[model samples]
Target: MVQEIRWGIVGLGSIAHTFAKDLALVTGGTLTAVASRSLEKAKAFAGEYGVAHTFDTYDALFESKEVDVVYIATPHTSHEALSIRAMENGKHVLCEKPMGVNPDQVARMIAVAEKNKVFLMEALWSRFNPSIRKAKQLVESGEIGSVGFVHADFAFYALNRDPDNRLLNPDLAGGSLLDIGIYPIFLSYLLLGMPKNIQASSHLYKTGVEMQTSMIFDYEGAQAILYSGLNSKSEMKAEISGSEGSIFLSPRWHEAQGYSIEKEGELVDYNLPTKGKGYTYEIEEVHSCLASGKVQSSMWSHRNSVDLARLLYEVRQKSNIIFPFEQQKEGV
Candidate 1:
């Protein structure tokens, strides 16, 4: 019989609820605990998910013996500290994207995880999506033949949202770049690796967070054009063009269910549906890594998180987009 991996969730936000529901679908994982600043909120979430433990503080959850691993779904600014705390307490961690607000925090998180000998992975679920895996395989197999350019955009209108909301608050590291833009950037990096150069621009909100951002990643012989924004809605599509053929990831590309390959003017569609809000794939990855006694996922390693954070840092630097906390940290 396989030993169950007991899981703790460090935030009771909507994303955490989604993760909890998906955790139920993983065979060797159990949602043993959840934490929130409010004990009432934690209890409510735990009751909804049948979790046996609840904590009013993140530190309590980290120290709980019921939790073997923690899913850090807190705000971007809190990820580094919470992940390190969990690792220091002998718990593995799967942190949400952006991992940290910047590269330095990511490095610290990685260092602590390494020192503690606990598994740590960024929960970039799209990387584990079946359709994305297929797309990568097709590109690697030369089906796209000498890929030359890729374009992706993720955008949604949040103009009417409250200024204090996380999406609009610089204090929370809110911005399209760190939120939605990371998806497009990830696609570019996965296919092209680090770029030779990065060119970026952004429209900042009155609160100082980026409202919309555009980026161009120049590679040796290829380029990726990416965009993300909160003032408009995009088709949320991604395309890869090559000398021989092209491939298209259907709408909402990041959480894509299918893709198409074009060759000789013929387009063939391949639909690969996901299971359980698509968070299940990453959950299963954590389970597989723990079962293998690994300290980091081979699919999305600690180095990958650092590299991704560095890219985000570069983009923000070029765009003059800095979170309030970062400025405070620098005494700006």
Candidate 2:
């Protein structure tokens, strides 16, 4: 039997709760510890997850011998610092997506992970979803021939959210582009490699954060049209068109539970169920990497995170959307 991989989670946010629940369903791993800024919140999460250890301070959790790996679920701006600290403390890290706000920060985090010889990966859970995996397989198998065009969107209305909420706060790197927009961007990158050209634009909220953003990625013989926003709801569907047929990842494609293939006047639907809110898949990937003595997931490597960050930076530049913290850091 494989030895259990001990897991620690920093930041007891809503996503962390879902992750903890999914961790319970994964084999070869257990949620050993959790931390939050509030001791009460840490204790509550620990109790709910049956975790053995809890800490009010993130550093305390990083220092705990009980945790072999730490999942950093903090906001976008905090990922770099927290991940670096975790690696420096000799803990492997699986940070939530948009690994860093910019390429430089991602490079630093990757450097620290390499220096520490600890595993590090971005938890872009969509990459591991069963439906998405199957879609990749079908595409690779030529069931869709050569992909030529892709269209995807992720959006939701958040106008009523308080101005200080992380989704709207510039200091926290709040913006549709970094938050939900990333999903569509990631899908494009996953299907089509780095684009030859990227054209993007955005509508900024009064707080100076992006409310809606659209992007067009030009490849050698293909193009990807993508959009994300916090101004209105969208169908949240994605389509990959090829010479032979097309594949559709169902609504909310990021966490897609099913997909369809269309060809020759026929449509085939596939239902790929997920375990425990769909986070177990990524957790299992981490366990596999650690068990194999690998420092990064081949599927979602440090380089991929860096490349994604760079792409996001380019998109922001084209859109003229800048995070307030970035401005402050640069003394702009």
Scored by TM-score, the top model is 1
Predicted structure 1: clash tally: 0
Q: TM-scores across all candidates?
A: 0.99, 0.98
Output the worst ten-in-a-row residue range by lDDT, candidate 2: 320-329
Write candidate 1's Cα lDDT for 51-84 as tens digits.
8999999999999989999999998888989999
lDDT by residue (235-314, candidate 2, tens digit) is 98899999999999998888998999999979999898888799999999999999899999999988889889989999
Question: Which residues of candidate 2, in runs, are more than 4 Å off?
Answer: none
Collision pairs in model 1:
none
